[model samples]
Target: MSLTDIINAVVSLKKDEVVENVISEINKGTQVDDILDKGLIESMDVVGAKFSSGELFVPEMLMAAKAMQAGLEVLKPHLSGDATAEKGTVLIGTVKGDLHDIGKNLVSMMVEGAGFNVIDLGVDVDVEQFVTQAQTQNADVVCLSALLTTTMPVMAKTVEAIKEAGLKVKTIIGGAPVTEAYAHQIGADGFSDNAPGAVELIRKLMAA
Candidate 1:
């Protein structure tokens, strides 16, 4: 019946309630922008905070993101072009030789929830694809994920390729094996170990 109801439903990871509340808000003639911003997006912000504070875990965060996605689906049809204008474009994918995606998938959802237009290139993505997509999509940031130590070298190669290509896009890397030191050693623009921190890092990179 209210935006707060939608927010609560998302925070509680109730997909049905979130969808119901979103539909109710739309039926009540609420602004789609308000429903998106004050309702769904704000819910993710709260979820992100809880995650940072250790009150939520990956499974819980995934559920909350799913709930938020449900609300977004209902609102999508009603959303005006301006209402869905993204803050920036983020190109995310797992580097070549690594197929793991739980962390990548979580970061993709979290980044999208934060209002960035995300292009997920899936697993085993090579440096050529990364460079090509960044150019074609006009991405503001390229996020590389690697779950294996062996695959971590590809992150560096991709970063080098992006820079060598003379593209202005910022590059970020993450995964269980990735560290700030490795990110620096590889000449990446930023690094994050968790999804929420990835969102924050992207925001900071965009602002810079």
Candidate 2:
């Protein structure tokens, strides 16, 4: 089957079918990166667009992400170092006192699908935790999520802490209560309103 066939399967949320197709392609000597980029990652881009356009909802996005992950499992081992050479590492989490995580989880999945190595720190992560992890992991980007307005200041503090520590990582903030202006005021390198946009923002920040 063509790579687009696999892409279609992922978009349709056929998890088993996506896994089978990925394995089949690998068996046929298809380049692993090609399968990941053309099939699975591309499918996520489409899914993201559908989500942003309101053509799909959270349940659908989650299913598509699951399908992509299923295919990723089959391809991971075969992906050599060179295949991941262009990918950057990201550390993501919701700020301290913010137990909300749906948005953060979505960003994690989408960023992973975009070929970045993601370390999800989970919800209620403190600034010290964020700074420590980013330093330890040598992450290229630090993403903070805050759903509550009260937690917004915590995100700012987290950004400030990372900067003050002289960590060589770009910071991005997002959530229902976050805005680009807020991100800039807090010294965040960037911000995005949705999961897909977050991936793009990270890409730009890394490239810069």
Candidate 3:
């Protein structure tokens, strides 16, 4: 019935309630931008905070992201071009030789819920595909994920390729085996171990 209701619905991971509240708000003549920013985006911020504090885990974060996505879908058609304008374009993937996707998927969903235009390259993505896609999509940030230490070198290779290709995109690395030291050693712009933190890192990188 209100933006607060939409926020609460999303924070509580109530997909149905979030959808209903979003539609109700639109019917009530509420501004699409307000519904998106104050309702949906803000809910993710709260969810991220809880996640950072360990009050919520990956499952809860995924549920919240899903709830927010549900509300976003309802508001999309009503949004004007300017209202739905993306903050930035993010290209994300699990690096080649690494088929793990849970962390990559989580970051993709969380980043999308945070209002970025996310292009997921899926698992086992190679260096050329990443460079080509970054150019093709004009990505602002390229996120590399890896679960196996053996595949971590591909992150370095991808980051090198992006830079060598003269692309102006920021590269960030993450996954269980990735570390800030490795990110720096590989010449990446940043690194984050968690989904919410990755969203925040992307935001900061874009802002800079």
Top candidate when judged by lDDT against the true structure: 1
lDDT of candidate 2 at residue 188, scale 0 to 100? 92
Tens digits of lDDT, candidate 2, 1-208: 9899898898888999999899889999998768977888789779878988999898998898888888876776665432255498999999899876766876787788778899999999998999999999999999999977999999888888998999899999999779999988988999898777898898898889
Q: Of 2 and 3, which scores higher on lDDT?
A: 3
What's the best-to-worst order under lDDT?
1, 3, 2
Q: What is the C-alpha lDDT of each candidate?
A: 0.87, 0.86, 0.86
Per-residue lDDT of model 3, residues 1-208, tens digit only: 6789987887788999999999998889988778877888778778878987999998988888888877876775565432155798999999888876656876787788778899999999999999999999999999999977899999999999999999999999998778999999989999998776898899899999
TM-score, candidate 1, is 0.62
Candidate 1, 63-92: lDDT as tens digits = 998888877777765644331568999999
Residue 5 in model 3: lDDT: 95
Residue 3, candidate 1: Cα error in Å is 28
Please say which candidate is ahead in lDDT: 1 or 2.
1
